[model samples]
Target: MQKIIFYVVVLLCLVVTKIQAQETFEQRAKVIAENIENITREEKKILKDKVDVINTQLENKSITREEADKMKIEAATFHAKRIEERVAFEESRLNTLIKEKVDGKIQEASADSVTSKRVSIIEVRYRKGNGNGKRKEVIEKRTTSQLVLAGGVNNLVTGGAVANSKFRYWGSHFYEFGLTFNTRIMKNNNLLHAKYGMSLVYNNLRAVDNQYFVKNNDQTELVTSSTWLSESRLRNIQLIFPAHLEFDFTPKKVNEKGETRFRTHRSGRIGIGGYIGANLQTRQFLEYQRDGFEVEEKQKSNFNTNGFVYGLSAYVGYRSTSLYLKYDLNPLFKNNSADQNNISLGLRFDLN
Candidate 1:
């Protein structure tokens, strides 16, 4: 009686296994069919979108009617070919599933769960394309960054006059380097931007007529050096934060989705702003001949230079290069017979 019961149980287990296999095969087949249908529908939708964009271009007079017609025809052909290839790929997958079922290799699972996932992935990829089998270009970014570099002549205007300057025009120089961030001011417009960043500024001045900066009690003055000198330079190092309101004149463009986008640095731009910072260090370098020997002296001191500094700056140019100007709003030194303000004019480059 026990042997007869075992035979009956074995027969029932085989029947259940066969039924599950059949169900799995049918479910997988249905998933593939649904995927095929989805591919066709998605391609059609994408093609319609492309046509809409082309029509928009035609209405805007951006493209001639002949060009628009040609574009539409190309879009249709491309989508049709995509549909054919994709359907063939799905059919091949279905055939593979059928063969697996015949070989008793397909496992029992819910195929509907995978169907949506696969279809969604394909939809994302198709949407990224521009109906020409190529992905669309990225249109815009709300914020961008640049590496700022500037160098040029440096001088100080004494008594608000350049003619009374004590520094040599060709000998003195300034250099600046920093990283800057530029953000669009409006949501749908790229005509204006706010640019802000930090910078390290090195301002050097070479006094004229063999003169060097001297600290006289509570005052700073330029006195004649006793020794014949080849170099007499006073340098001030500063760390400053700069902010600007920039106006960009780059033309806007329309994307495949008929959305207007702005691209910067493609045309001329103007930036007007200011900077404020504290003096980091001040030093005077002297190179001369004394006692029939080459002598070099580096004097480190405050020399009554201003501790806090603020300046007005502006730039205007095409693309990445611009003519830059900066002028200090405060005196160069705290205690002095005549007030002298630092000024700079040079070429500035902003590399994105």
Candidate 2:
């Protein structure tokens, strides 16, 4: 009778331990599920934020609706894939824990035939895709559009005897700014692209000598100023439309659509092309110290300069930063006694 009582006590203890182990497994599995869900929720928020940006871009006309939609689709697909992978990992972990618990229960109750059977139960119900289709698919056409702003420095250089003359470039005074659209030309070949836009270009030349430009019929003569001048600057503003065929050498990144997008101009790029536009305004700016006060003077005139201008422009560099050079095929002044062409070199920024 005592032996039977001892076996009864042992059996009762094993049953209690198995019940406690099952409860612990359930709690752990619940915690794991919650953690996985939290991480997925954070990732979804990030992807949604990107979609919001794309929508804003569309509303602003910075990007086309098709482009914005494409971006949204890509973001959704990417987010879904990430969630699936993470859930799969967590599910595997939970399965291992449950399996260990069951195996332990079986071992502890091995003396009884009723409680020693293996328990195998796996529930897998996962939602897939962006809910747009039965099978996952990515967009085939990949395109991007954005508003670009660029600004850089400018200077002038000449050829022949004038090149030998002492000339000064006002480093701080010369610059150009443009609002443009940089787009890929071919869908597959992202390396080739076209950039076209409107720019407000300001070119300032500071002569070393106390000289000013004088227009005589068709002649633009560089003559000395009658009054002593503290500063003499020639300011020319051109409303230009520039176009370039660019080659991007930087590594490309594959998007969700399996299409490649060129790295930014800062990454490495080269552009070769030209521009044709009209000179909007030209004036001579003079600053002097009269008595003890500073005096400023501006003389607005054509100075026999051409109304229309065309130039050859090229740039090479990495990322959005580049070295820019431009040369006018025609003279700055039409049919002048002295033939002085306009050539400028500067740095450029391309918002890609």
Candidate 3:
């Protein structure tokens, strides 16, 4: 309530000031034009010097073609910004002048004109207000929204190394990818509300370890050989949903220059979730060897060999996504008393 009253008082003061500042449109336009001319003259002089250096450097081989071109581009951009600033200054001056002139005219005219004008040209008026505050507020809101969207991508592209191995380890052919999406459900000057997430992924896992080659070479002479390489493959599909408790730190607001900016929000998140799914496995492609005459041979399973499947999951990552490693507590082959399991290190893209 106090803040609101303070703002209202400030607005009243602005209106009073605006009314008193009234002057002829022609007079204000002349002042604006003069200021614009002065700005142009100064900028033009600086631009001339800059262009001279640009040309000289381009001709002299002091800088490479790429470097010179880059310099030119920079100068061009500076020139453009200078032009925009001059234009803004002129426009602001003109607006103040025009508002003063029009207001004075309306005040001097019959009372009916003032009423009519307020209903039409001036939809709102406070003792100190001229609508500028409201306009500025609207612009600020739009700018903040734009900044949020532009900066939102920083949340999606995240990665972490597999640093440990428990029932889970890192450094395998294990990998995961997903499309994450977030929507701001709520936001305020002090807080923001949002429920955003991701859906679906092409999860994959594969690894092969063999010791036959080592033993085979120990006996073979000139023609080095191994017991033959045995291979095992584990593959699965996973889907996880995460809900995050995020605390935002830094805040940002657009400057008078209409540029969106941000400071670090160094936030922390505690996410809880589970992965519900299974992986298809190929236990082994069998083959045989003999010392006597060779017999008939059988081929192996293509696309998919093993039909073993199981589910396992773990928790990791921050708000938007996390790195995860899950292991299968189940065996891959039936009746095959081979102790085998799946160890997968992957990432869970958050869809909360």
For this target, which candidate reaches the highest lDDT against the unseen true structure? 1
**Per-residue lDDT over 1-352 for candidate 2, one digit per residue giving the tens place of the 0 to 100 score:** 1222222223222221121123343334435545554656666688879988998899999999889988888887777667647755865675455446436642322223212322211111224587767755343223322222233334444453335543464332444544455666765455787877666566677766788677777677778877788877787777677888988765566767664544434257899999988776788888988788899998988777888989898998865557788777777778875556677765565532
lDDT of 1 by residue, 1-352 (tens): 1222222223222221111113454445545545655676677789889999999999999999999999998887787667757865865675456446547796644434333322110101113577878887443447776556677789998877877678999678887756677888987777898999877678999998999988999899889988888999999887788999999897787768776766666579999999998787789999998889999998989999998999999999977668899999999999787889999987776644
Using TM-score as the measure, the top candidate is 1
Off by over 4 Å in 3: 1-171, 189-227, 239-270, 275-352
Q: Ranking by lDDT, best first?
A: 1, 2, 3
Clashing pairs in 2: 265-319, 265-320, 266-318, 266-319, 266-320, 267-319
Off by over 4 Å in 1: 1-141
Q: Poorest 10 consecutive residues of model 3 by lDDT?
A: 146-155
Better of 1 and 3 by lDDT: 1
lDDT digits (tens) for residues 1-352 of candidate 3: 1222222223222221112122333233434444544555566577769878977877887778888778866775676567546655755554444345435652233334323322111111123445666432222221111000000000000123222211112212433322222222333332332322322222222222321111122131112224332332222323332233333333555767665443222132222333333332212222224555333332222122134344444434443234554544444333322333444544332211
lDDT of each candidate versus the true structure: 0.73, 0.60, 0.34
Q: Estimate the TM-score for candidate 2.
A: 0.55
